[model samples]
Target: MNRQAQAVVLLLLGGAVIRACFTDLYLNYVKEGLRPFLIAAGVLLVAAAVMTLWYELRPVPRAAATGDGPGQPEARAGGHDDHDHHDHHDDHDHHDHHDGHGHHEPRVGWLLILPVLGLLLVAPPALGSYAAGQAGTALASQQQPSDYPPLPEGDPVRVSVLDYASRALFDKGASIGDRRVQVTGFITAGPDGQPILARMVLSCCAADGRPVKLGMTGNAPAGLADDTWVEVTGRYSDRIGRDAVNDAEIPYLDVESWRQVPAPKQPYE
Candidate 1:
């Protein structure tokens, strides 16, 4: 690609990054902590692209404007003579052709625009049920069981899917007791086609995310499509099952009620 094309690509890419940083879209791919770094990197890329365009478009100085010495005419004449001689030799040599501008940038450089356009025009959605189904429940086995604080005073206290799973599996349901809690996550199908509540856990970005699933029993709704975001009110159960794909232990939630809800701004925990 030419320098102009490179500058355009860089400008689009930088703009896309800045736009994602300002919006909630960046949460789909990465952690909230990386926003400042992403914004700074985008600014640097934009600055570099602007500088490149300015340098390429700037006016060139003429030889006469430089006040060349009298001997310059003779030097120019000799240079033309050498050029004529080379042209004469090339007239008979079929393999001596040149494109004149001399730049040989790889054509593959244009491929960079694909990702730039993707980010600017149609950013990808966050990892959903398909991604969750491919992986097993992620429970921190190294975490020892302990007394967890009592649930806040609410008929159905709001809690994250990961926290509920950890308390149910690691704490052996002691912390959960008989209190009804509300959890929100997308639904994924289990081995027997039952709806499972799941959320992805990301240490850094979506690439390293793994699912934390809870088997929905009791009055849990049926026939909900995968990736349908919902709020479920339920109590912990002693029932546990193994993942069909990886045999990871999945805790159970005895759901009492459920309702479809819009997806959250931050999909991962």
Candidate 2:
């Protein structure tokens, strides 16, 4: 229909596909978390595309062919609008490209504005550190029988991935240090020749998660792949190292065994 409307429709259709496909990851510079909102935005795009196509395909009524006569516009069997709407412009006749056989659709340019407004006003939320780097990164439901098995009821000093993470970030490993604890994550390389220490990040899926690695030396020499899940059992030593993004060695657990686990269903922090 109009130039602006066509642009809007095409934009919405294209944006939907891009967001859906790439919404898995965000900026590499920032160790971030999975962005569920962007995924939702992508879904919206697909819906907008379908609506645009529908409006374009709808048919509209064409003027009568026999009406070279007096004031008669879209004539029907029963009388409706009695007012003489088309008396002056009776002589004016617009030519149709096709023969009067097929019906024509009015430009549905009006519908395209819906998603355009959404895109402009309310963009999707971004992957933030709050989501991925939080202390409580693991989901309880995703826990397995013994990924980091529940400690036998004894001193009750064993901390868990959920426990350490859920605590205040400023608290460090204060509560669990020198106590038995367990965690699960992917195996990543530690700076220097340090073995045993590895990093594992949890994200919404595998995409938007910030890398939260458990530093343990002398574990796996080959290290681990980019995204491998592992279970480590050790004491929560509060030895501050660096940050996850900066390769900073924050205090990590001493690993007993970094068992490789399957990627859980909800792969997020």
Candidate 3:
């Protein structure tokens, strides 16, 4: 590829990497720990771009400056015979090195700008209920005995969906006791149009997200669409049973109160 094209590609790639790190759009695709790596990669790419630009812009030396002195035609011709011949051969090899072996400016290089545009113009949406349902749930680790701290004193203690699910499934609701807890999560429709409060837990990013859902009992809210974020105040129900679809014990909750709510900034747990 030409130096200009190479520089442009580096600029686009570097800009995209740096932009993703700064805006946290990277979190949609990768773990939080990857921030350092992204930053380093972006810096390297930008450095490479600057170097390429300098190389492309550097002044070319004039042939006259390196030519033989006046009144030395024979010497100049002899020198030209040796040096010009070598230069011609070297130029051919250089041309082959740069442009041969199917290394012509890759048409795919333009595609690098697409991701930058995607990040800057229209960022993609996070994974939603359809993805959760289609992918199903996968526990992060095998069931182990765990002792959870007592719920903080509150009429309706706020808790995370994963914490509640872990306590319910593994600890058998002992830690939860009879305390009423409130949790926020998006709603996923159950088999019979029932609302299942669900949260997606990620080991890295949305690609590896696994849904942690709790079935809600009591009065099912009317006109509750799928993927609607909600805050539900509820207690663990004694109606735990094996789910026929996934053949896993699905935790159920007795809903005391629920209302539609705005989605949180971080969609994943």
The model with the greatest TM-score is 1
Who wins the lDDT comparison? 1
**Per-residue lDDT of model 2, residues 1-269, tens digit only:** 44435646666655743544464323221233334555565567656656766666656434353344456545454664333334423423323333543344455757766665554456443333334344322322233222232344544343444455433133554544355555654544444435332233443333434434444643442445645566666665554555434443445555555577775433333
TM-scores of all candidate predictions against the true structure: 0.86, 0.45, 0.77
Per-residue lDDT of 1-269 in model 1, one digit per residue for the tens?
Answer: 99988998889889999999999789999999989999999999999899999988988666443434465533355466535655666774544346444456788999989999998888999999999888877774437557777778888899999889988888888988999999999999987888888999999999999999999889997888889999999898999988887887899999999999999989999
Better of 1 and 3 by lDDT: 1
Candidate 3, number of clashes: 0
Q: What is the lDDT of residue 261 in candidate 3?
A: 91
Reference-based TM-score, model 1: 0.86
Please give the CA lDDT of all the candidate structures: 0.86, 0.46, 0.78
- Displacement of residue 7 (Cα, Å) in model 2 is 10
Ordered by TM-score, highest first, the candidates read 1, 3, 2
